[model samples]
Target chain A: MNRDAPCQDEWSILVVEDHPATRQFMKLRLRKAGYRVMAAGDGREALEILKHHFCPLVITDWMMPEMDGLDLCRAIRQESWEGYVYIILITAKDSQEDIVRGLEAGADDYLSKPVHPAELLARLQTGRRILELERTLKERNQEIARLSITDPLTGIYNRRYLNDTLTVEVRRALRYKRPLGLLLCDLDHFKRINDTYGHNVGDLVLKEFAGWLQGSIRGGIDWLARYGGEEFVLVLPETDLAGSFDLAERLRRLVAEKVIATPAGDITITASFGIASFTPGGPENHPAPETLLNEADQFMYQAKKSGRNRVVGPTGNQ
Target chain B: MDIENTARNLGIGRDELLEVLEIFLEASVADLEALTEAVAAEDRSRAGAAAHSLKGAALNLGLTEVADLARTLEMAAKDGVLLGAEGQLKDLREKLQDLTQAIQA
Candidate 1:
């Protein structure tokens, strides 16, 4: 809300008037008010300026050669733009009918000619407030979207996000004929640890593990998510079976070596991993995501059955 | 006529007031010349446009006499009635020249 900052104060206004003297007067007045100003002789000139420079505020005279203020306002409203443009029309037509005409032509506000300096500036302040409100609303909407996709407890992406993004990744891999890898990891004897250490300490351990897995994965290229209670899913794009195995081994070693400092004290933990990869159009190509996940889930149970802390894949325990 | 009061009401300093007055004088003279030519050629639309433009500048600068006369001429042209338009234009022209000289002084 503090528009005194440079970024917030950089809103520019365009003034379009065929009369050079009036154009200069408006430009100087607006510039004095700490607004960046651009001027054009008529609507055509204003459109030319708009093609390259994005001016969010426009003040135009009603009558001019070639194109008038109403024509300019209509043209602006027709085009699609990233930011909203606020337009004010200044004209000698002071009747109620004239005001209605201007508003219908897409002018946000109207001013009679012989414009009072104070009144003009006040209208512009209103325009600034509206633009600021729009900016704040857009930012808040984006934050809400991000919050919906993230896990509240672990601060990692939630299962809902994993479900949506994994399908898109699989389709992309198929299109490019690249391999897509999925790693399913479950904490070893997690329920027993929770019963021994209490739920608070158990929660701390889960949070710590999530942070560690997020840090260990490749930034931007790989993503990890909290699949459910004690299970997590890692998505590795463009990775083959060999690459998945190397990553699984590295993750297993990292988990075995790391110690989590909780309120109860230092606790070392290990997790079992199951890595499954889908090579596009291979002899055993996975036709659906559910089947691929079932294969990984089966392999993960195999790892748990063989021992507690190890990785198992299609070839068996490794 | 109340030039200082007009400047104070506009919230502009004396230098800005002088600059605005100077600009209005120059633009109004050219517009009045165009109005004269349009009237002589019996081009009512051009005459109306020129008169309307002059009226706008005069009102902004607080040239009430010039603005009133220009407005009358503009309305006459718009109505397609040349009657009394020449008289109104002559008076508007005289007021503009006098105002220009006063500003220069």
Candidate 2:
């Protein structure tokens, strides 16, 4: 509701008219009506102002020396901008055919000239309303895109994001002849904890574990994602097998020592880690993402078989 | 030139309208000069453009007499007819002079 309010004071309207008197009158009335105003002698000057400054609303006269209102509208529509520009064309030619021609040339609205102050203000209000609606819709679309990639419970990247981004990371590493490492980790006996303390406590422990893992990684070089229930994957760029193994061992110990204090009580947990890495040797050695994931899964299974709370990498157990 | 009535009709304050009128007078003078030269040279396009500019500004300020005279000149020039354009130009000059005196008074 606050966004819907007429916040005219925050807006600047560009007035383009070759006639100095009309331009002055429009500027005075617009400023008096709580709008900041900028004036240009013609459409050419208007474009120059728009290049350096952002003005969402424009009122222009149909006839001017350098460029006219109809051409200005067409020029504005041809370019790409961060936001929409609302244009109103002022014409003395009041014929219906002329109105249609103006609209066809990309004018959003048209005003008959000898512009009455009240009518000018009213038309500008309509332009503001349309621009506000566009802004709200743009923001909503960005939010929706963000929500699609985020995990609801842990607030981390979800499996879909992992699938989408991991391939890109792998391709980049291979193309650049760099190393890429992956660590797949699962909490030891997670189902038993869920059955013993109830699913609520289990969910809390998972969220806390995710937070810890996220914080421990290199901020931009490494990323963590919720692979599935109680399992997470960390992708480390430019990290070799040894480096990933070292990180895995450190994380395994950290998980074993951490005491997650939940509403139920303090609970200690252990986790198993399997590390896999790709060092680009040649085209023949390039592996698909599924192969890398499967290799990590097998190493993790070996870690679980030998003992819980341990790290298994390509070389052996650690 | 009833400044109060004109200002009220245009939905603006008298002071603000007067400020605009000051600018209008200066700009219209230049336009009048341009129209005079264009009519002398029989350049219909230039004359039409100058008259068009004057008409737009005069109409905005509620100066109906000036606006009506400007419209007649503009239409004649647009039709490529410069006949009697001198008389219209003379009438326009007198009206502007009267408005200037009124403002000074």
Candidate 3:
């Protein structure tokens, strides 16, 4: 895939040098090259700037008052940052031992001073290339993480995500003595629709149903997940049985009324909803995630038996 | 010093080189004072640090005479010998004055 061209203005290079004239010269040259520049008098000041602003590239002088370039490299490596910092240590010391010491202290590259502006810019371009590679890899890893927890068809949370998070929600609710509600829903006669209108139409109808339910729920407070084919689970925190029952009833009617349009034809479908809730002082023993799921599953089975397209709660069918 | 050639070699315009030279002149004066005090007190580390700072800035601006003198002074201070440091400091003052006049012209 073609990516957007990298903008030079977005690449900020931090210059750490104790000499005022040299610092000014570096800032001037880097700014002329279209890069954003930040300057510090010494390594200590550089650390202070880094605390507030993120700079991926650093050009430092080896010998400085208070903290030197080597110490700065070590300190930066010790602290965990959101992204990698590429350091280029600029020094007049050209000995082999000094180069090895600089690298050992975490300098990605080294430059001998007096640093020609052309050479400095070239080295920084190298640093930017590496930083760009790191950024792309990090973004791809995050995308993979997101895909692992997302359902491919409906673009909602998958069963694996539900299993992992539901346990955490249960622990949190119990620890905080807060009420939690779980709803298990199944599309009524989903397989029959697949048989009558082909699986393509059935898939479209399922997508429509999932989208409708996802839009109707509280975004961050409540979450909906596809438990399996034609079955979904909604976990609601800080919600009691009565609240969940009302929501399930409302959703039952909405699903029954929605007409889903597909390439084959338009189809109307209804869903059966079952809700189970945990109150702080309830008499239910050991309200684990499995117990809640089983209770909701039982109520959903009851709703399916009672002619379908209805909502069932712990109290009774509605 | 060939100001135009130095500016071109450093990848900057002559005007920008002049601006940096002005800053260099001001900073080197301070470094010179610090070096003077360090030589009077026979403080080897302070004298070496002062000379090192001067050498770095002068070298960046392509002031060869100033940089060479400052490097010599730095080496002497580092080795804990201030024998010729006073004369070198005087010569460094004269070189900086000559640079200021050249830039002004």
Candidate lDDT values, in order: 0.84, 0.89, 0.90
Q: Best-fitting candidate, measured by DockQ?
A: 2
Ranking by lDDT: 3, 2, 1
Candidate 2 per-residue C-alpha lDDT over A86-144 given as tens digits, one digit per residue, 9 for 90 to 100: 99999899999999999999999999877777777778889988999999999999998
Candidates 2 and 3 compared by TM-score, better number: 3
Question: Mind giving the per-residue lDDT tens digits that candidate 3 earns over A102-162?
Answer: 9999999999877777777778888888998999999999999999999999999999999
DockQ rank, highest first? 2, 3, 1
Please identify model 3 stretches exceeding 4 Å from their true place. Answer: A1-9
Tens-digit lDDT string for candidate 1 (A204-302): 889988888899889999998899898999999989888888888888889999999887889999999988888877876644666667778888998
Residue pairs clashing, model 3: none
Predicted candidate 1 versus true structure: per-residue lDDT over B1-105, tens digit per residue: 556676666665557777877877778778888888988887999999988888776766566788889888898888988655788877877777777676666
DockQ for all models: 0.37, 0.56, 0.52
The candidate scoring highest on lDDT is: 3
Using all chains and alpha carbons, the TM-scores for the candidates as numbered come to 0.89, 0.93, 0.96
Cα lDDT over the full model 3: 0.90
Model 3 interface DockQ? 0.52
